[model samples]
Target: MFQTDSENDSAEPHYLRLRNQIANEIEAGILSSGARLPSERKYHELIGSARGTVREALSQLEAEGLIYRKDRSGWYVSPKPVTYDPTRWSGFMTYVAEQGRLPATETLQVKTEKQPPAILDIFGKGVRNPLYRVERRRSIDERPVLVEDITINPALAPGLARHNLNGSLSGVLRDVYGLVVTRNHVEMRACALVRHTAECLGVKSGTPGLLVIRTSYDARGRVIEYDQEYWCANAIRIEVDLTVA
Candidate 1:
């Protein structure tokens, strides 16, 4: 049902024309989210273009976040990314729920490790404390989107490893330890997906993504947790509210 004969008259490159045709179909609702795209060979036949041309067009679409590829699987239209507000104090489940999407976390690993230099710098020198390292994969609407590595101060919340780590850590800190997170110091930057992260998110290494480092403090200004979260760039949209005095 999709044709590009009329586009041949244009001056655009063959791949560009093919890319625009597919993009138009996606925008016009002819292709739905999660819909599998035609195979590269099939597309070449349909558009009367070279196979390499079809591949280039698909690669372009993937780079633009209009589509994504699964390992050993072909490309599919990307779903709309989730909107996130970093200023909000609520946890992942809360914000995702507000957007009418299901949220889930899979705890990958939890163990004790010596405090890293960066964390020790924040907590101050002369402190010898063993920290709990937690690794988790987070999903929204059943789609894997984020991977997190959290370091917890055991002195602040002893026996934290005994509880379920798949749920909200903030909730556990508040309800069990009475350590409420009052403020957070956060830094954000663009990063490429590492091997471990790519395997977890089912994406290729070197894919562009967002990296967030957050240090949460309790009411008394005590550092409670240090977290590093890697998010698929196409799976989230970051928003912040700003005010000028």
Candidate 2:
């Protein structure tokens, strides 16, 4: 289905032609989500195009969010990204579950570390003592979607590490520590996945992704948690709602 003829007299650029052909296939449902694409060499051979042309075509598709690449594996059609509303007070698991998707968390590492300058800057006296650092990989319906690095003030929840860390941190804070999160200051940006993040998310380094930095505050206006979350660009769609008085 991907084969192209060299003698075809199309005026379009080679890469554009290839990209459009692949896009048409995806649109027609000939290539479904999660379907692995042909290897670069195979695609080049099938289309009789230059290797660079095939690579460029695939890269374009990836940028358009139609395809994704794994580290050692080739490209695959991407599933529809999940919709997320940062303004909502709901936690990740709750929101994902509401969307009819199963959400799971795997605790990768947990330790106490000296508060970084950035964290200290955000929390100041609130984070004066050593911070409890937790790295977790979050998945939806068995597909890894994001990784989060969370820092907490140990003083607020002593012996927190002894409890199950795979569950909701927000739930733990509210139920166990009696710290109800009342507000979140969030900052979002588009970024490429770094090596470690990419490895954790099963994507190639430099893959396009979203970065969210969140500072959670308790009812008393004390910073309770600082969270850095990296999400696959193809796996999330962010939405915001505003009302004016």
Question: Tens-digit lDDT track for model 1 on 1-245?
Answer: 54555556767798988898899988887888789988888897787877888999999999888898876689899887878888887788888888888999999998889876877888665556678889999999898999999988788888998888788988888899999888899899989997999999988889889998899988777888889999998888889879997
lDDT (0-100) at residue 196 of candidate 1?
A: 96
Per-residue CA lDDT of model 2 for 142-226, tens digit only, reads 9999999999888899998888889899999889999988889999999999899999998878888999899999878888889
Inter-residue clash pairs, candidate 1:
none
Q: Global CA lDDT of candidate 1, please?
A: 0.86
**Residue ranges of candidate 1 with Cα displaced over 4 Å:** 1-14, 45-50, 71-73, 241-245
Roughly what TM-score does model 1 have, to 2 decimal places? 0.84
Candidate 2 overall Cα lDDT vs. reference?
0.88
Tell me each candidate's TM-score: 0.84, 0.81
Candidate 1 least-lDDT 10 residues: 1-10
